[model samples]
Target: MSENDPLLNDPLLDEPQARRRWWKPSFDRRRILRWSLRGVVALLVIAALYYPVGMLLVHKIDDDPDFQAPATPEGASRAVALAAALIDREVGDYGWPSNDPFFMPGWALDNMPNYQQGIIAALARFSTEMRDQIGRVRGTSQVDPDLEKAAGQLSYSPTVWIFDFSTSWAPTASSEQQYLAAAKTLRSFNNRLSQGQAVFERRADNLQGTLDRIAADLGSASAVLDKQVEEHSGDWVDFQADDIFYATKGRLYAYGLLLRDLGTDFAPVIAERDLKAAWAQMVETFRVASTLDPLVVVNGRPDAFMRPSHLAAQGFFLLRARTQLREISNILQK
Candidate 1:
């Protein structure tokens, strides 16, 4: 059409020019794109800063002068509760029978008749501490010696008599003779212990289940203690915070030994199966467990103890480790 045509001469004649103008980038478009890019960059910067800031804040809060661990009786109660749960899941809730090799009379280690009896004492103390704390919470002061005794009787240990008795003596004839006699006496005991450990090792699912149960128990106890701290703040005024920290430290120390024994039992299997990643994950889990030591609560004051945070952290670390351990178990199962 001619440019001078009536339709072209009309106001709508500029429509093509307007369309071309619209197609061209304007200052507004440039400004918008620039701001959009800046916004995207700003978001990335914030995302990058998020983790470091969070970690620093956590460190500062944990290191604050007011930071305190849970009260002693509370920690003791948790330890007892977790131990009881672990025992209940592995052995019978009432513990192994008197005739079991891992039981008191048969729990000897190189003539040490009462070798793992400390486990019994600690198990019994769970009830003692729990009752004592619960009593104090309710304005009472009494303990059931009978209950403590009964708890001890119900204590169990999977690793109690699973030692290498063959290595207890040399390969000489005299040693062999002595070992023969000892071995004869312990044949039934050794067989039973071996069978128990074998059953545990035969399936990765079993190990995973054990770790999952332990982690669940620990997490549950930590949550319960968190609730207790909130509910019984008045009861914690003189609850001996340092003593609790030290006691927890002691528990962690003992746990280190348990971890060592576990590593010893499973490391070879992991190596044999060429499960390097699984082994590393297990190592990391143990490392996290080790972090729950004296350094976390040694110098903190009683009133300043962040009971909820500390317990939550403890439970979290355990759960993380348990996850890794369960992964290892899964790998072995595969």
Candidate 2:
């Protein structure tokens, strides 16, 4: 009998057919197509909702302004981000980057202090970034402790970053003209010599007043000494007393001379000359004072320091100081 023959269809076979399962039925093309279409539609809806959201995420991960600081704002940063994405394609582990340096160690930059010869003009970009960061911090007093401390030690003027015409020359850019104008306004220098001259005279007068007080104190002390000596007609000689008395008198005389010289020096600072000239000269003198190296540690001598650090001397520490200053000044500007 044939397999499809009715004679072969036994009662037991019919019983098994009666207990049939629906889920275990043969696969259907229509069912598969329907499910596939449903899946695709779901994906489309999700993508439509997340397209802008994904853009935001991408921007945050790769194009964050803070992350790209000290970098040029042109196409280079975008190129970097694209190149990063392509590199991730080849390496399965690097596909989705985590900002954690530990997880994505490839981004770790090496030898920031070292120069690269094979890569020509690599440092050019970094220096350009630094120049830009410096300009961004104007009018704000965001002070970096490290840079402030370092600049304070060197007496480097914060305003010098803007004011020093010789060194603070603006770059050949449109923005620089504005900076130059600001610098000029901030200076607002007067043409006449009278103002600084007047200030200098006041300082000199103060010195004179101080000198008069010291003179009075000394005179009173001197009279008392003379009267005491007169009281003792037959003096029991005190050798140490004479030494102490003479030393005190000598100190007073030296102090008086110092005050007189200071007054004399101050008299010239306010001399009635070209007012602009006086201002310029006074500013220059203050600049000179600011340039004096700061004494970081106390030495036995008045001008001596235990350890000296400066921009030219301790370059590494100075770099750190500069970075701190950049951050501080940025905050202040905001």
Candidate 3:
């Protein structure tokens, strides 16, 4: 019992201190493990809901074949107004999904992105035609500054987000921003057109040339469909089929609307050339083609009995529309 006695300093006397140290560490570890597991489970629940809910909210494919643009102001080109309206509806209203970052819900959407990009592509093509042919007096005439700007902006890559690491590390314009700019420029061009300060040639030759260009584009799209059907037919699950189908649908839908309005714009030419029936036929063909929506896109063999090839069906309509366009162009030439 003396202060420095060896017998009094026995290891057993320190048992309470040792047990306290061991028990404190054990309790702390259990508490930390329980909290870590709870954190992991909470993250899992959030991640599980993130994409599904996000996709449900963000996914929209507005393939309304009968959709019409709001009426243009008096003297404005209806086709031009329609183009601007389409751009606004896609980029501003629905939100351009093709350029969304991985963190966004739109990034998970494949069909909507492809479809919207396809609409933009068609609009870009039409703007080019406007700048080069329709919006000018002749081939040698200077391009309209607004139309030219719109064309260039609309042609910007649809997949570029805020940052394009391919070109530079700096933050760049997103696709939606470029498209919105294009829409603004298009409206500017239309405003100038309404004021008679811009040229929108309604001559027969100009109409013929524009229709010819659209026909060529449809031909190219048909070729793509042909290739896709030839190569990937009969797959149980054709992942690429839906992309191609929706993109083509978008293009056809846009072209159908534009051509419908352009008919009104070129009414004098269409009437003078005795092309009312032909023009109507071509526009109707585009309308019908644009409305072909399948619940599921299947790339079945063209000759398959059980599964039908939607691509082939779409190609048939595309070719028919192109042929009708060519017939109308021939009549316009005459």
Candidate 4:
């Protein structure tokens, strides 16, 4: 028990710091391994749920065939009202996913973006026609300012996001902003038309010109379908088929609605020309084409029995509609 005792002053007891250093590293290694295992498991869990959950939250086609525009204001152009309503529904109600950023779930989506862009393209064309032909009393007359603005805004690229790296590093107006502004301008034009301050000439010639432009657009879409079918047909997994399909569907859907309302807008011309039946058939064909929502798009040969080419089927309807449009345009010329 004495401090000077040889047994109490052993060398092992005097070097406790060395023992502590040896054990400390072992403890630290075990702690690091445990944390690393937990980190890996957490990452695995996130990776497992990231795509499926994100896709569920973000994916929506919104291809409602029977979608009706808000009731047109009395004395306002029905077609203008429909155009504005379609833009509002897509941008505000349905949410524009075509311009989603890389971090968003929609950025990974292909079909929906194609479909939405298709819809916008059709609307842009319609707006251009409105500015050039429908909104003027004659070719020499001044263009309506609101219609010109709407046409320009609607024609903006659908793929632009809040920041466009290709053109500029700074922030820019997004596709949604541009489309919504177009919608606003369309509403303004409609308001002015209702108040007798704007021109929406519903003459037979204007209707014929509008139909001609629309038929030309349909011809182009049909050609796209034709090219896709001709090249990629009978592939078991044709990746590009769905993109073309949905884009065409979106275009047809928008045109169907627009032309339907335009029929009401120019009913007097239609009745006078006795082209009501042909116009109805054309709209019906577009309706059928727009509603072709296959679970999987197959680019089978046009004559293949087992895997029929959806593109070919869609082309059939597209061409039929285009033909009907031409027939109606001819009748209006009489």
List TM-score per model, in order: 0.34, 0.20, 0.90, 0.91
Per-candidate clash tally: 4, 6, 0, 0
Rank the candidate models, highest TM-score first. Answer: 4, 3, 1, 2
Clashing pairs in 3: none
After superposition, candidate 4 runs with Cα above 4 Å error: 1-32
Q: Evaluate all candidate structures by whole-model CA lDDT and list the values in order.
A: 0.39, 0.29, 0.88, 0.88
- The TM-score leader among the candidates is 4
Give the TM-score (vs. native) of candidate 1: 0.34
Candidate 2: residue pairs that collide: 142-328, 153-294, 192-275, 193-274, 193-275, 197-270
Better model by TM-score: candidate 2 vs candidate 3? 3
lDDT of 1 by residue, 242-315 (tens): 33333332233333333333444445565667766665565555455434544333222225545333443444
Candidate 4 local lDDT, 242-290, one digit each (tens): 9999999989999999999899999898888887888888888989989
Over 4 Å off in model 1, which ranges? 1-201, 228-256, 267-269, 272-274, 280-313, 329-334
**TM-score quality measure for candidate 3:** 0.90
TM-score of 4: 0.91
